[model samples]
Target: MTTEVIKKPPTWFWVVSVIALLWNLMGVGSYLMDAYVSIEQLEAMSQEMRELYEGRPAWVTACFAVAVFGGTLASIALLLRKKWARPVFIISLIAAIAQFTHWLFMTNSVEVYGTGVYIMPILVIAFGVYLVLFAKKGIANGWLK
Candidate 1:
């Protein structure tokens, strides 16, 4: 008896996967820069926003960086349909939710200037759900590996 394997993805999957990789890579770069650089760098980017370093918590920064790196690695594994994709995606899903919560619940009620529009929060929620559920279909179907 031979086990049949599914092969190849729809063209859209390739397109979405590329988009997801680019998105995750940006997260990796932003988190890395924020965690390592001085507050002056962030202040220069946003002069109105005050730094909230809370004792300069290294652990918090490390964990945040790890979450971003996990997403980056998962996006890479996704291209190959590696088994690690699901767990990595899961981590990203949770982190995305946590980030969404922080923005929605923890931020000040007063709006900051140049926050890049209010629609960003909604887009993030939509993208988080899409990446977690639909993006991994190829991995499940054995087309990714």
Candidate 2:
């Protein structure tokens, strides 16, 4: 009988996986806050902020949900050493790009929120891409089965 050897992941693998989980959890928290903001909370915002929040399209919200939730699941899969993490991370990355595309191009978010608004979306997309590449590398290195 032929035997198969399982490769052990490096320390960095665990570190990255944990970071991914925490990042995605924060995304999920952001999504929840946005999705469930109360009327009082909305009224407390400045006119521009209120308009931006109330005027967001439903599809953009859907994309946000998919991106954050998918990333969270992919993070869990990575921690579990599952090969499925790669594809899920790819999906999350695509959704994050879509969500950010709307924020960057289809809306006046940058103008309303000032240049500072760009930072989070840019970081989100960058991290999404990084996680996808990391998962692929993990699979290739036999760190993820």
Candidate 3:
């Protein structure tokens, strides 16, 4: 019987994986908050913000859930040094792209929240892409099994 060997990942790999997990956990928190904002919390928002939040389409919210949830799972997989992290990251990236596409193009988020709103979404997308590439590299380098 043939056997496959897995190499030990470098320290930086562990560091990055932990950071990714924390980041995606924050994303999951954001998604949860958005999904279950209380009436008091909603009322606390400015009119523009409240309207924007309430007006978001269900599909966009669904994408948000998938993106954050998928990324969180992928991060966990990465921490476990699982090769499946790559595809999970890819799925998360796709969902992130879809969610941001609605926010950037299908809505007046920029007009309502100004250009400042662009920063977080851009960062989210970039990080998602980085994670995908990182997972792929881990697989290629035999760091993931």
Candidate 4:
């Protein structure tokens, strides 16, 4: 039997992978701060916002954990040239969607935070989908193994 050899990816692949890693690291930092937000910080929020935060379901919190942590792990996997990055990124996207769903449906986030809050969620979904597709493209093009 013959074995297949793959060519090295171009400079853009490394560039994108590093950017993805840094982006996900920011998500991780955001999650840590959200999880550990101080009482003073909580009190500083508007009453509606405070209620939204204090009343969040535990499962939604878990989804936030899964979304950021999974994305970070997927970014690391991508940089390491691991084929597992695709599925892990897909999982991260699903968790992100779930978190967004909670914000859009289970709570009055829009009513409270107004239209500006939509930007971050939209970016989160876009970036999550982009990373998953990027990983898939990497695998298909033999940049990942």
Worst 10 residues of 3 by lDDT: 48-57
Descending-TM-score candidate ranking: 4, 3, 2, 1
> Which digits, one per residue and each the tens of the lDDT, describe model 3 over residues 14-132?
99999999999999999988888999999899998888898988989999998999999999999898999999999989999999999988888899889998999899999998999
Give candidate 3's error at residue 55 in angstroms.
1.6
Instruction: For each candidate in the order shown, give its overall lDDT on alpha carbons.
Output: 0.65, 0.91, 0.92, 0.91
lDDT of 4 by residue, 1-96 (tens): 976556598899999999998988898999999999999999899999999999999988898899989999999998899999999999889999
User: Ranking under lDDT, best-scoring first?
Assistant: 3, 2, 4, 1
Q: Over 4 Å off in model 4, which ranges?
A: none
Local accuracy of candidate 1 as per-residue lDDT tens digits, 49-143:
54343433455555556557777787777776566676787777676666545544565423653456446656755775677676467657767
Give lDDT for model 3: 0.92
What's the lDDT for candidate 4?
0.91
Better candidate number, 3 or 4, judged by TM-score: 4
Off by over 4 Å in 1: 1-4, 42-48, 51-63, 109-118
- TM-scores, one per candidate: 0.71, 0.95, 0.95, 0.96
TM-score computed on alpha carbons, candidate 4: 0.96
Residue 57 deviation, candidate 3, in Å? 1.3
lDDT per residue for candidate 2 within 1-145, as digits (tens), equals 9755558999999999999999999999999999999999998999988988889889999999999999999999999999999999999889989988988898888888889988998899889889989998987888888
Residue 134, candidate 2: how far off, in angstroms?
0.6
Better candidate by TM-score, 1 or 3: 3
